[model samples]
Target: MNTKIIKLDINNKMYETITAKQGDTKSRFLLFNLLDGSIPFSLENRSVRVYAVKPDRTEVFNDLIITDAAKGYCILELTTQMLAVAGTVRLELMVIEEDKKLTSNIFYMDVKESINSEKAVVSTNEFTALMNGLAALSEYDIYKSNAKQVPGIKEEVSNLSSQLDNMITLKLLMDIDSTNYRINDFIMVDKITRLQNIYMANFLRNLRNGSPVTIACMGDSMTYGHDVNSEDKRSADTTPCDNGSRHSFTRASITYPESLQKYLNKIYKNNVTVINRGYSGDYVKKGMERWNKKHNANLTIIMYGTNDSRADYVPEEYRGNIDEYLKWYEQAIIREILWGKAVVIFTPPKLQSFGDLDVDTFANGLIQLCKKYNVPYIDTELFTINYNNINSDGVHFNGVGYEIFGMKSASVFVSENLLKPQYVKGGTKLLNRQTVDNFVVNGTYSYSATSGAYTPSELNNTGGSVLNLNPGSSITYSFYCEEDDMFVIPYIYTGADKIKISLDFGLKAPENSIDASIGKGATPLDNNKSSLEFTNSGTLLINKDEVFTNGVECLRIPTKGWHTLTLTNEHSQSTGGTLVINGIEFMNYDVFASYVNINKYYRQNYLKYTSHPILGDTASVSEIRIKPIDYLKLHPFYYLANTEYWRNPPLQLIITDYLKGSIIYTFTIGNNSDTTMFHGEKARLGAYTGGRTVSNITLDNDTREIVITFNSGLTNKSNLLLKLV
Candidate 1:
């Protein structure tokens, strides 16, 4: 078979050509297609390693695949999907035979001269002129080195050139109606003039404030705005900006940051200055480099890490790079601010993984960085499943993708108060500025409770105790304060699990200026009333009663010689108006809870040892802690499940109870999901008496149990033993 490499342009014009016979396919062939005035080609594999002799360096990027339908042979199409790329795309394709061996049929075809339409020819000429003009203006590249010091501005120039290519590509794709075309042309000139005015005004403002705000959108190909639409649905070449340099992937008009500014202006009514510092193929390291340029930003969002692992950057190494950069990033951003303050950071959206393990490592690393640096971060990891919602490429977001992204990141900034709109009316829309419930309190209040409002002092130790007694009892609190501001009372912890307090306040009369009602449990209530009376229907008991606000207000509990008084709310839930106490005078031994094993089950009776419960096996717990205490020490015989056949090993049991609350404990297991069958008896679990032993708890042949002696200097009420068979 004969082989050939053809250089084709958008107008069907050919530049350079290479023709080969069947012998040339033995090795890979490098081809360059001159589209319009730019050279571009496709790489056949997941990644292509390219070595540019001019730069004397080797670089690798994800490859774009193309196929030759005209012939039976498979080809890699490296077409520009967007307008950000210009000039020529250097491509290399390695073809292999069906026998898993190399082929020797390299071919080159020239298709650039085949201009089929007048429009195509005009576009090609225009693109050619633009490319030649750009090449004439700059002779040197500054972004050539990865050295510590600021490299030359070649990288910056390259970045700008890429962006221009992107803009041209978008302009070419846009449907320019004759009338609208002229209108847009006028608008473009106006926009350019407006940009100059805005830049000058911004410069003056920065001069007065002595600090300039720098905003950047950093991410992978998506952040740079890659492919969106294909000219022909069945073209097989779906890449953006396929045959034009002026229309490249990093164009300004289609990029998220560029689009976001327009959105911000519509929303804010005033143009907010934003600098598009986005670059294609940027990862965490690239993000750090951009930040290092000393750009003053009041709010800087970091959008990356999507390609970090895909590009094969190890998590730990990526983490280390990020950690180091964060230190400098924080310091630099703060220094660039009007006052020294850290810039806002946003983690990149999740990437589609061939498997779960891929994205997990990256997600965990991002979380760790955010937590350690105390930087406010967004949760883009959770939004990856609906990734197609915001992304065009499984990795990069499209226009809609960037739209959602901008709205989300902006929401986060607003919620964190990192960004505040000029004016917002009352309602949920305006209320979104706060992430947590701290809007009115200007960094002064400790935020004692979850209810944005503070609790009353009565139940809390803020002043005096309203109800402080023993077990199984309750008390009521009453007051006659005028209702002006919203009243919120939070039940504080008087003791651990020892108390369960219910507080409900009420109005004296319906016509009595205010209407008061009780809520279900700890739900916040808006006590808008005059003379309000709150009643707790049970006697006050230790561990059962809840303390109200701890520090915000002063309480006036019954100072009239504290004689178990019960006030009536006159209206409430669970109301018998009978004050009862349900408190344990002394902590009972039966009540002490302990997590004995890891990845196994233990009977709550004898604390017996076994691979699993005598009856059956439960679930597995991988990484767990019996917090406030350790579990492995309590149960030593427990081992990791079957080394060979490991299913979901029973690691911990998630215990959830409505009244008793919920707790999880790591149990013990001897083998993994290796199917094991048991035929007979189990051990007995009994309490010990004297120094020898006492109770004989027997287990039938079918029953599972383990007997153990409770040796304690303290009294034994009820002991729970997990007997694994």
Candidate 2:
């Protein structure tokens, strides 16, 4: 049979909930979704194992018989005796699909005991619980005075505990060594500082609710917990290592996966379960089949691409570039999202700069995937840049290094409003491209009104004056860009089948001239291939949804200067049906981590940022200054002329809220000569739902301020926009 687990719930609506009646009497019977499937899966290969933890000292563990299977659900005949336990019942379903094994996240049956005691049960201080565990696990397991472990630990814990509203951190740190610890494994207490899990609202929500949510990890050997040797064990194997003789904690006995489980167990009060589906030595491509059929998670953190630079790793078609790995990644992410899974992609930490495996180039592209797919990701590439010697060789992280990653990831999810209940959907709720802020206004431009040419005309769409292409003329838009970046023009195309336009993009200066030919054949820089002139296409619809999907695309710009994008209706077949346009969008694309690293390199070297910031939303910096460069210490990577990546966003802020109210936003553009303001002169001030989506909105051009009002309360997280027409 071909099938996989969606969730570990029973009856597709409930769990293995039962009751412990008095004496030896049973309570109720229930059906379980044990290896549910369609087409009536063969019972010969399926199995269901259920475990129960009772109120007393008793426990139950047994295999359930699958009586039937149909309609994507299996039936387990739970007898009255099976539901006789009063505590917590755990259910696990296992299925085989195409020779690969699949397991579901544990399903909990909230069993209630029939008896209620009038006497109160003793409660333990959560801190006392933590201290007890630590005392037993450490070498200094005994109390000195019948005294405590250390004055510092107590004083600090008391101080933090006094301030804490709840035991969230202690809950997180307690699970690290309690549940999954082995002989060689021990908790790094000093390493368990309260980290900032700012982007983990969903994880925290599940943790607080005691709801089941899976965190799936995909990667190569490092993620598989490969040690100094025995690097091929795909599962979380810790028994084969001879390296245990080398040190107390070596490859065979340590894993960040286990550490993360411990951390999660603490914060979740042993409520959350981690699915460690790590494959040993598995590249992203090699793990696709397994991930697709078996690994179902609420949040998946992918830590691959570390092996892309290897000789045998890069695929044949993806050679000569670091971005080739993203092609595979892009496909995988889309599949995952389509499967109803939220994903978090992480940029790998800086490596030992092997061969041509350029970290920055690859890292920047990974961020683009997040923007492209509209998913969330962590930029550890930025965090790992400051620390050195965290690796065993050039590839693996040692025990301390793994612990650092464990604590770092937990901190990101649990620290200071990191899981602030809002951004829990991850960056999925974020706009890949902010339209209002990236608009370039050009009312007056040169035009060619020749035979079958195109002209700039305005069409009425959604009660707005929309830009249109008039056949027999061509319009050119000129704009200033600080760095070489990509622009996605927004327009509505409704022609016969598709609308193809010939594009002319180039630098204003003759010295920096572009070919503007069919395939962008001209190149001032002999080596670097700048994807300039091209034929762009969009869907055919005379009147379509006002979106940025179908528009002219200019991939990567080679030069940063005053440039023009002349989109001509060269395919005269569609020249009869001109494509309407709203405006162009600047995908202010940059890896946050890479940007941090590049900037620190400049500051440490005191190198002036001899470039303009590609200002955009989401990745803006707090400060901006333009000054003279100290020639003595110019960081090689700070040269804007040759640098394809940029590190800063202009000093601009747009606070968008989802609630019913009026918000007055104020901004200053020409405040300084150092940075250029977005919206240039084409600032169309309004809340950007549509041309006039929100009825009550006003623009004060003199003050460069906007007032937006709503009839109904807005969502807690909302995006306000402006557009240049």
Clashes of 2: 33
Off by over 4 Å in 1: 1-214, 228-253, 287-292, 312-341, 353-356, 382-390, 415-725
- Tens digits of per-residue lDDT for model 2 on 597-626? 333334332222211133232332222222
Alpha-carbon runs more than 4 Å astray in model 2 = 1-204, 208-210, 229-252, 319-323, 352-357, 383-389, 415-725
lDDT of candidates 1 onward, in order: 0.31, 0.39
lDDT of the structure predicted as candidate 1: 0.31
Score candidate 2 by TM-score against the native: 0.29
Error of 2 at 108 (Å): 55
Q: What does the lDDT read for residue 461 in candidate 1?
A: 47
Q: Cα deviation of 645 in candidate 1 (Å)?
A: 50
Model 1 agreement with the true structure over 1-725: per-residue lDDT tens digits: 11223444434423443322211211222222223333232223322211111111222222211232111112222211211122222333332323342222222332222233232211111121124232232111111133223243233333543443443221211222222332112112222223333443454344223343445554455455554452211111223321221223433225556555543432233335566555555565554444334343444555555556555543455543545344333333222231222434555565554664543455455554444334445555532232234445556655555554454343332111332222211111111112222121111112121222122333334432222222233332211122211222222323222322221111111121122222111111212121222333343222212322111121111111100112222223232332222111111111111111221233232222222233233322121112101223234332222353133233333222222333223333324223232222322223322221222222111111211222222121222333222
